[model samples]
Target: MDRLDIIREDETLEDLQINGFSVIQKKEGFRFGMDAVLLANFAKLKKRDEVVDLCSGTGIIPFVIMAKNSISKITGVEIQDEMVEMANRTARYNNVNDKAYFVNGDLKDKDLIKTLGKVDVVTVNPPYKLKDSGLINLDDRNSIARHEICCTLKDVVEAASILLKDKGRFYMVHRPERIADIICEMRSYNIEPKLIKIVHPSIKKRANLILIEGQKNGGKFLKWDTALYVYDENGQYTEDMNRIYYKRDDDNE
Candidate 1:
């Protein structure tokens, strides 16, 4: 199929701004956010490591990792069929299908988990709010992406644990208010929390997001990295933020 044929009427092709990669995003449905970008950056992977991303909306996390890492394979598990189709088309557009793909199946499905087998790394940017906690979006897609209508926090952690190889790494980005719940779930599945970084909108603001990394069947020690401020006091993107977004070159610093 031609490149234009891959996109649908309701979808827009947005530039990822990395290695000439772009993604197909629904104009009104759930789209990639800064949290997903931050989570992808927070993950550390070895060469040839296989990675899986749970709740991979539009496969953004997987694509972001592909831009930065030389991993053997990366799979994105998304429950939404439309998202899976769009993501696969984007993969073909980038000619990265040999190394990256998206699966249209629930992460909590046992059969899907069996098919995936073991992977070296698992990353998730799961729904941060409980189903009943906040005002849910009227759109079913947005609601599922923002609230735990399908998979809860525990479910995400358990799936990651089951899919990970021994000592495999797990990375996630979530709201700071849920830090306690995240730690509890990770530990319950033997995914030890090893590193954490709080993300603040600015220096004066309290942290609203957190980036966490864990290891399966690993140690008990945890280390806190330097806090990340997205913007400077002058309301400009911080140097670190600019680098993460690929807006600045490392050599220039």
Candidate 2:
């Protein structure tokens, strides 16, 4: 068995140990560690909410959810055994073992859904790279985590649809280029894309990513706008981003 290592962070986690935080290689391939935190912060978690994070790696999103919202319970679905193992360790370390657990299986599998039941909300920071669109990473773990090998964007939205209850919410992040495809896919599944926030590197550059929120079996009313510049021209974090990730109100007295 491959032993896991802890991922120490500076401002984000501080001493919070990610005992099992590492890349995992499965039949499909590798993924990144930071994807967890990105999705965690994007989920807009609420109290006592039943949340499920699909394609959860190292259980980062679930752990983050636990930290921010103690009353919510999370179930993470990960296809890789190694990732699940690490999430288990992290869960124990964080003392949210009972609140969150991981299951090993592809997100597209039908049989696996029975165990998780239905959730009030589902979040996925799914694979963004197209298999043939970009150079394939020789590393299996890295390749699969970024590229759409096992599940495409449509497949992810479909899975989220099935996993959620009627009117349940689905939140996710994807490449800005695929915004049209995302809107079409969600609408086809009766999951109305209600909220959207376009993510950009700086105020000067075009958007590269977008955070979208949809509700299952919802009306066709779409609501969205830009999240604004995350960084300044000097490449430093902007005021809004600082308030978000750091949870600080710099404008406060």
Candidate 3:
């Protein structure tokens, strides 16, 4: 299919700057952000592992992982049919459809979850705000992407637990304020928190985002990695942030 034929008038194709990969995104809707990028980077996957990404907006997490790792296969589960169609087209346009794809299904659906079966890894960049906690977006797409209108934190953790194989890994990026709730939900589903990393806007500011890695049916020990700062005192991207974005030669760092 022609790349131009797949993108709608309201959408644009954005380059991921890795392996010539690009994703189709709505111009005004919920586009992929640094939080998604950070979670993709935080996840460590084996070469032969299969992955399922829940709440996979525009399939960015799967594309990022595919670009960085030679995983067996990766599928993105998105509730929005528009996003899923666009993501699948993006995958075909990039000529990686055989190994990467998106499904238009809700992560909370029991039948859909059963169809997905078990996977080696699961990743999610779920909605960070509670349904009624913040001012909901006027657009339905943006509202569902930013708030827990379709699924809550517990829903996300439960879906991940069901999708993962024994000793499989689960990775997520969420607001730091919900750390306690996140841990509780993961443990309740038998997903033990293994690693935690805090992301700050700058050295002087408090953490705004948190990245967590959990293993299904694993040990209870949890390790804290060094905090990541997005910007320096002068409001410039930090070296670590630059590395994550592949701005330097040491991108693997």
lDDT winner among the candidates?
1
The order of the candidates by TM-score, greatest first, is 1, 3, 2
Runs off by more than 4 Å, candidate 3 = 137-139, 249-253
lDDT of 3 at 209: 96
When summed lDDT is taken over every stretch of 10 residues in candidate 1, the lowest stretch is: 244-253
Question: Which tens-of-lDDT digit does each residue in 33-63 have in candidate 3?
Answer: 9999999999999999999999998898999
**Sort order, lDDT high to low:** 1, 3, 2
The residue-by-residue lDDT of candidate 2 on 100-131, one tens digit each, is 78888888887777567888889888888887
Check candidate 2 and list the clashing pairs: 29-141, 30-140, 30-141, 30-142
Candidate 1's TM-score: 0.95
- Give candidate 3's TM-score: 0.95
Model 1: residues with Cα > 4 Å off, grouped in runs: 137-139, 249-253
The stretch of ten residues in a row with the least summed lDDT in candidate 2 is 8-17
Backbone clash pairs in model 3 (N, Cα, C under 3 Å; residues 3+ apart or in different chains), count: 0
Model 2 residue 200 CA deviation (Å) reads 0.8
Quote the positional error of residue 21 for candidate 3 in Å.
Answer: 0.9
